[model samples]
Target: MKTAYEILDVSEQASDNEIKQAYLQKVKQYPPDHHHNLFQQIHGAYQTIKDQKSRLNYELFDYPEADFNILLDQALVSSEALTLSADSFDKLLRASIDDSIFQFSTTHKINNT
Candidate 1:
């Protein structure tokens, strides 16, 4: 699935004017009269990230389309080649817990101080 940015062929950091220009170019290339579905897709993509607020909202809420079967297939394929020793897994868990505790303590100190 193409993101709005991908559909419009613009970078995430593109300015509003740049986004608008890209949208205009897309519309010209796929006008509604001649290419209804493509035009709708372009128009919808434009509406999603046309401006700063809309872009922010889209980023916050938009979930990419996913195929669960493909994801499961990939996960199953990868799992066969990857194995974790018990000791390594234990160390990883301990490290993650320690890091979380450190971060919490630091944040708490900063908030209180």
Candidate 2:
């Protein structure tokens, strides 16, 4: 239930510059080279509230408590315990094929360039 402001140790009404300053301070304390886990958290928190537009969008989409609890419950379940349907399997296959094609095309384009 922690907001990006909480993660960055910034106030909810903090200006963009204030959020950036807090985020930079946190990142300096937990540099990616040393504290990768903490760095990712700080970086992600910064990304969530980096701009006024993003902050507004995030604040506007507040899920109800019940919905939030439902989402958390669903997230807690292990992916390994779930069974994939035939449609999902097909989608995965298509995605893999598309990824391969995209990679090949990009490589080819780079070589040509």
Candidate 3:
């Protein structure tokens, strides 16, 4: 629930240029030889708030759609446990498909680019 302003170490009254400057400064201070998880978080926050439309989306607390699909294998469950109903299985399958498509498309686009 943290706001982009808080995440970027900038004030709410910070100008667009100031925000960018702060983000760049923070990134440089971070350890960058590896994945640098903190840097990525900072960068993501900056990216989210930099664009006008994205800023609006952030302020509005809008989130992208997500399909929750987690397959539970029967073998993983105890024999005494109840079985998954057909309706629940169907829902899970649909969610799995949606999640797969989303991930595939995103990865393909990045690789192609």
Candidate 4:
């Protein structure tokens, strides 16, 4: 739900040139091969809010309490999916759980009671 500008230490009003420059700086500091999770998240955030046309489509809604560390990890997983090479295995795997998230949400907590 956050923007790339925030992650890259740049202003939201920054222009394309500014965004690109910021991205380059971050890449130099943390390349994907070295910082896989962070790089994946930065890539996702940049893609989501880079252009005005796409930004408008981005949506956020108030939810119950959320632990950001977990949410960020899930986002990172989704971002990694975007970078998969076409040569990657085409098979899809699906699993189901009783929880609403199908066991995906960071907020999911087991009640031992």
Candidate 5:
């Protein structure tokens, strides 16, 4: 899935005006009358991160789609020369899960406040 920034062809650091300009260009390239689906996507992306607050909200909540097979392959290749005991691997996985949960809770609390 393309991120709003990607769809708009704008950098993540783009200002509101820059994003608006990019959106206008995209609309011109894919006008609703001739390219309904592309126009809808562009419009949706624009709505998603058109302003500072909206961009922050989207960044806080948007989770990228992960390719598990690719991740697994990378992990296996990286660990090929080293062997992890069952207990060590289990500990590593548990630690990663714990870190992710902690981060989520922290972000949730900050957003709620």
Candidate 6:
């Protein structure tokens, strides 16, 4: 479940040249003929950061931890206990847990490098 940045082995704030260099290095190691899956992932990651516009759009939508917390808190508060059955409540809880895990992973990835 690595982010594109992780796939490229580049920092979130990597410069264009740095990203290009990393992509090239990765391609050299995992050429498409022999490593099609890995090569595709590397290429996709490169495309994501290949231009300023695409990079800006990606960054703009990458939600912060606080935003996700706020959203989850709102969901809990907005839920009507009387309207949801036990099973529904369980499902909601599971979704909340999943969201939290996703948030944690994103945060971890950002902080790891």
| lDDT (C-alpha) at residue 105 in model 3 | 72
Per-residue lDDT over 29-92 for candidate 6, one digit per residue giving the tens place of the 0 to 100 score: 9999999988998998888667544554344355231234434443555677558788986677
Work out candidate 3's RMSD over C-alphas. 16.3
Q: In model 1, what are the clashing residue pairs, if there are any?
A: none
lDDT of 4: 0.53
User: Residues 8-101, candidate 4, lDDT per residue (tens digit)?
Assistant: 6766455556767777788888899999999988777667556433332332222233333443344445447676554431221111122344
TM-score against truth, every candidate: 0.55, 0.53, 0.48, 0.46, 0.56, 0.53
Candidate 6 regions with alpha-carbon error over 4 angstroms: 62-113
Query: Residue 14 deviation, candidate 6, in Å?
Result: 1.2
What digit string (tens of lDDT, one per residue) describes model 1 on residues 1-113?
Answer: 89998999997767779999999999999999999999999999999888654664465347344233443343334335256566764554344344565567779999998
Lowest-sum lDDT 10-residue window in model 1? 66-75
Whose TM-score is greatest here?
5
| Model 3 lowest lDDT segment of ten | 66-75
- Write down the lDDT that model 2 would get: 0.64
Best by lDDT: 5
Model 5 TM-score is 0.56
lDDT for each residue of candidate 3 in 1-113, tens digit (9 for 90 to 100)? 66677778876445568889988888778845664887778888898767433453444343333111111232113222266677765554444344565567779999999
Q: Model 5 over residues 43-85: C-alpha lDDT tens digits? A: 9999987865455446545634433344334344445527777
lDDT of 6 at 25: 96
lDDT of model 2 at position 46: 91
lDDT of 5 at 34: 97
